[model samples]
Target: MTAPTARIAGEESARDQGLARGVGLWSFTFSILNGVVGAGIVALPASMAAAAGGYAPFAYLAVALVMAAVVVCFAEGGSRVPTSGGAYGTVEAAFGKGAGFLAGIYMWLASVLACGGIAAALCDALGALVPALAGVGPRLAILLLILGGISWINVRSAGLAAGVIAWGTVIKLVPLGLFVAVGGLALLVGHDPAPAAVAPQGGHFSEAMLLALFAFCGMETPLGASGEVADPTRTVPRATILAMLCVLVLYVAIQVVAQGLLGAALAGSAEPLADGMRQISPALGLVLLAGGILSRFVWIGSDVLGAPRVLFAFARDGMLPAWLGAAHPRFATPHIAIWVHSAIAFALAATGTFTRLAILSTLATAGLYFLACAAALVLRRRGVAILGTPLSFRILPLAAGMGMASMVVLVAIARIDEILAFVGLTFASLALYAVMRPRIARAA
Candidate 1:
């Protein structure tokens, strides 16, 4: 028993050593930025304006405050687990395989759906640019090219993927920065900043928050690649906190500029940011439209870099076939995993509308966050050791509880159909876990 156990442990260590730790603090921070600031910033301004009139920015603020606590919980979990499965690893460590598997599905689905939703949005922007290509044929072709190309890059190298994301972040932010600077200046000069509509009434505020939450939801998916991160305990929390801060500030600024510039017309504009930019210059408005398209392309690249690792991790840990976990000897990356998920994402992007996919992804991520917060308390109580230097701030229970409560509230207020789909997925995960339990134990 001792000899066999030693041999088994050795094999597991060999498997664990497969992935590269190419993602450092800055790279990981950029990953967080790349992950969070995708199509949400590009396309949601009008939706937000419609939901809350001029008060839309406050809804973003409201959600951010609650999500901040959730981020702390995740930061703590990331430090402790610091593995590829990310939230899956943290949750599994606290509970059992069954619970971990369920959380993993949520993490994986959230990434795929978000990527698909953004992909659809990208095509929509393209359609706007070239009305001739607005038909389904062109949209499908575009998604194929972007998804196929980006997934190839990911299969080749994690470092290469990170580089793409890091640079992509700067490129996408340019138009947004210009809009805020130029639009904000114009507003100050002689702008009528009053909103034509009143504060969010009826269920409008609730709806506003749902959109705001989507803007914030994609940030956490990158944490699924914690194993690729160098010195995760040092890197994860710092990078996550900094990126989340940037997201909050940037989102608020964009909302303010768009609102003040467009005023009463903000809600009615299909292209709020573009319209606001056009008020100053038509050429600038075109830039914003092009920026939206570029943002989605970059976002899909980031999704490939970070999300497929969840599949690789699952395969590595024996939750699924070992082939899914197998790193390509030539590239030292999870090529099979990347390809498999890319295919699924493409299909979803082809079939689903942006709004439907965004709502589904948001609800999935919120549920995942709620579970992770609960896992944080369990991990602390179980004395899960930090993978590197300990955090300076204490992991307060109040914060964990608040995060959990916030997620519950988020899910509770979403459309009933979305809630039902979430529940259905949860049950499906449990059923699959039970069936796979024997294989899981054998792998363990």
Candidate 2:
């Protein structure tokens, strides 16, 4: 009996060592892209136009370059650790468990709030298409429906979630790609793209550039699933680079077309992409609306897949309930964590507005970025190595420095309320950690 029990325990341990590792290069790339390119991409041109006029495209370009440094830093740290929890795990490796818990909590809060906002946005987007859903009750119902469906898919299988996100990304890009192609061709044939390239102001450009950062928020998402990724050291970095390039191409093309077609009108329009597409053709406007719905789903799906993994990581570390660490025996997915995250997010969706949650999410994500960058510097200095050959780009220190500086700039630009919310969350995390320390020590 003892021998059989030992064998069973060994088998369970072996299964626990593997997090499915089903995520391939392409799927991983899509995950990063899905994280970075959310529904915000569609109307972002308008916001940029309002803020920077002719310099809006340049703002996008500059922000992308700055964000690249941050991504590189994350890539470096992820390669060294190549585990779940993303910034949380990396920071824990460098700083210690307490720091990791704090980082993980920030990320979890950010994703949960962002998920709520996405659901609310999804409801609004659907309402625009179907007037019947304009009422609060109907919208809330739809939000619940969306969350339920996504949670079901995620709890069933991580591979399925990856597949859905990848295919959803492809689908989401179609309308934007078409607009870019048509608009770019028009520009090539002696047509001026921007009819209103007004002089840009420094103040407006600064604000717009900061706003553009929102479009690139999800670059660290793929890292959250590192345990599930095959050859994470190589795959994570390569996927990060590829996803960035893809978004850069798409963003540049879309911005140019949107700027050219809408000109000054882009600044004030509610549906910027649809307005720009309408200028090309009325039919294209409808395409933009349809695409917006698809993009929202992709955004929510990305968050759903990411946040729960962080919770799973916390549980595995004994920061949360131990059951959350358990993957579904059949599906090998973190079913318990996913359901809990979905439930809380759904509650937020029902009660919260998008603007409030967006502000909080932005601040939380910026905080996470600061920690991730700082961890990169610390880990490299300490010279830690994982079991596998870690990826190295030789610019880790530089990348970390730049990434930290960029995050500081971001934090400075953030609103006062956001800063306050971040501080509050940090305190809350500390309190929770203090209470859980004894239990965690015993578990360890």
Candidate 3:
């Protein structure tokens, strides 16, 4: 048989032609950090404390423990396929082109809607940062610059974009890191009275865990750049695991510090992190204000690096127009795909219509994770490996099983509107798949 990594007889791998394979272990990890640790981190402690009490950190830890299993499936899929595909190449390997096509579009649609919502939020954030940008003309300019700039960078080079995400990660982390460090110090010196025992509340723990799930939601985002990652067979797995652990540690520490410093008041403060930092010193608190802005900014940048690759991946597989998968000769990047994705987001941001589709967010996340875990089980059982050789991970079966159960929990807790949104999107996507499958087979 031909080597597993080989493509179609005529079509070439993007990496073989112009797609730069330059993203390394740490940079991809940074991309993950930037993606997962968004603006929500700053505001999360207050709600978590209210719901889970001092056990707030434990609730987040509980979610992370479950996520560890889920990332294993992602790790295996990415290692086996090692391509720039949606979810992971293991999906198509398990389910074939038709189902794979559905999964691919499913994720791409979510990204498009998410990008629009994020873009609008970014504009509002920038407006808050610079009062001068509040006018329609100024806000429009901000949107253009933000979206256009990120697209230009990604189109130019995935490596360059990774570098930007690295700095963006640090820029946002400073305030959060400060909050943890200073707050911990405050406790040490008895600058604040000892925090009350925040024992876990069983009745509310489940609610808190589900809410905490969003903080861990972006693990799959950076994997979209499978085509550009260097040593992906090992790199993807390591980054996925490490980035998650780091976030879990960081989140738990921040929660502990906030709980110790703010105590009962933490459960009520709307701006817990910012307020906590302010208590240390006014200047530090002011810096935390910029934290939210920087966090969202980096998230949008990381999102640009991620979600477009599915578009490029589909086009490369002949499920979409080939032009989208074409790599830029000079930059070795998917410029066309990047531009097109950005355009959809820009339109959505400008019109403010992406909100209608926003309800799909939770359901879309559940579907994607379920598909990935299912793919992992199928691919492992089929003994499939598409990357010439697969890394040996002894925990595949156990991890995948647990991942599926975690997904079940996610779906079990989803609200009714989310279920409706999921059903609507599924029917619509399957109908489109039916119409397109025949043409693709005829072409083949």
Candidate 4:
């Protein structure tokens, strides 16, 4: 007999209470884009320049190609499962409940830590505008306020949250677009691109590819929102691919423009994109700064929106407390889970432990991506066709293999402290899993 299928418990409640299947293709695409391109994009070109020197833009493209394969694997898994837990659901469907639990917890923890970083960045942005907000008390207050605002937006409805995300996407790109247009004009008028003296090498190129991978970290947002989409199997794959393509173009453009203008100083500048724009015009840099702040809002909001759904998925599947899976009677949203996520993120951001946790967060993200790809490969080998159709390239196994290799490289490149931390978390989670094994087995 085939393996048992694990499912969440609240499908009818979701429909009756308030969740609707109305997200269109455009909305879903922009939502994923919002998740993938955040304030991180503003800072990436600099770090990439540090790692890969003058060929930094090429690093972005190489990693994008690798990540695109990973996306295809996730797309296949999502098309099969198309549930809230996303990678969690897909892995469990192919592997078992045990594997699913690990994936879910890993993703949830990573998202919480990432939210802390975003909150801190937002506070810094606020502090830049209002110097008095730099105090610990005021910073914490503002962080809590922003976190609360995001929770409120997500708790009400997914549609409203998606709309906010879509609008934010449009607004955040305006400054970047302006910079690119002007920078291109300058280049056409005999301005030299890449005035930097550093040259690229193989070792640095690999390191840069690894660094750029994190920039694409949130590409799984569409998978997380699958349950709310109107034709998830079709919409998910299309949206994921399109979002990746758009982001790839944006990342390369930003890197090229920033590197050309900043030259030798690109790697040292904290605000590379803004600095490059400043060279063109100081006023343009200010606009890019504003856009950078706005971009943080978009991604942080997307994180708050997506992270809770992972817990909701687990709770519904009987992997965690059922209360977490409960949809609000009136709102039809997972309000409890959302609040819990917001609370944890707020606490981490307030205490500043989130920075330490960020390394583990990257490891966990890589783990989840690897597991999802493996699941897709396993399902394919087992003759399962849950993803509906093969990818246009008809290379599911190849894509999965490439994704797995990338994850290995990422893990290998992780710092010693991050590896130790990841190992410790893995063992602790294993112990917890042993205790929950009976429950998981029964649910399955």
lDDT by residue (tens digit), candidate 1, 1-444:
234323423442353478888888988897787678886677788778777876898899999998888888888877866776667767776676788788888988988988898888887788878888789999889989999999998888789888877787788889888988999899889876534444433237777887788899766667767878887788988999999999999999999888788777777665678878877889999999888787888888877887788888777767877889989999999999999989999998999977678878888888888889888887666656545444534745887889898888888988898899999998987887777678888877
TM-scores of the models, in the order given: 0.86, 0.83, 0.77, 0.82
Root-mean-square deviation of every model: 4.4, 5.8, 5.2, 4.4
lDDT of each residue in 1-444, candidate 3, tens digit only: 243334421132533457788999999988777667776676667667777776778888888878888888888877766666637455765676777776777677766766776677667656655779878898789889989999998988889998987787778888888888888888788867324355334357765776677667766666767768888788888888889889998988888888877777787665677667766787876687678667766777777887788888667656676788899999888889889999988888787622233434544666777788888777666666655566656887888888788867765665676666677888887786677666567656
Q: Over the stretch 12-53, how does candidate 4's per-residue lDDT look in tens digits? A: 223224557688889888878867777667666767787788
Between candidates 2 and 4, the one scoring higher on lDDT is 2
**Pick by lDDT: 3 or 4, better one:** 4
lDDT per model, in order? Answer: 0.80, 0.76, 0.73, 0.75
Q: Which stretches of candidate 4 lie over 4 Å from their true place?
A: 1-27, 79-84, 130-138, 152-163, 190-207, 227-235, 322-336, 350-359, 386-394, 440-444
| Best candidate according to lDDT | 1
Give the 10-residue window scoring lowest on summed lDDT in candidate 4.
4-13
- After superposing candidate 2 on the true structure, give the runs of residues whose Cα lies further than 4 Å from its correct spot: 1-16, 19-27, 152-166, 189-207, 228-233, 321-340, 347-356, 388-394
**Which scores better on lDDT, 2 or 3?**
2
Model 2 vs. true fold: TM: 0.83
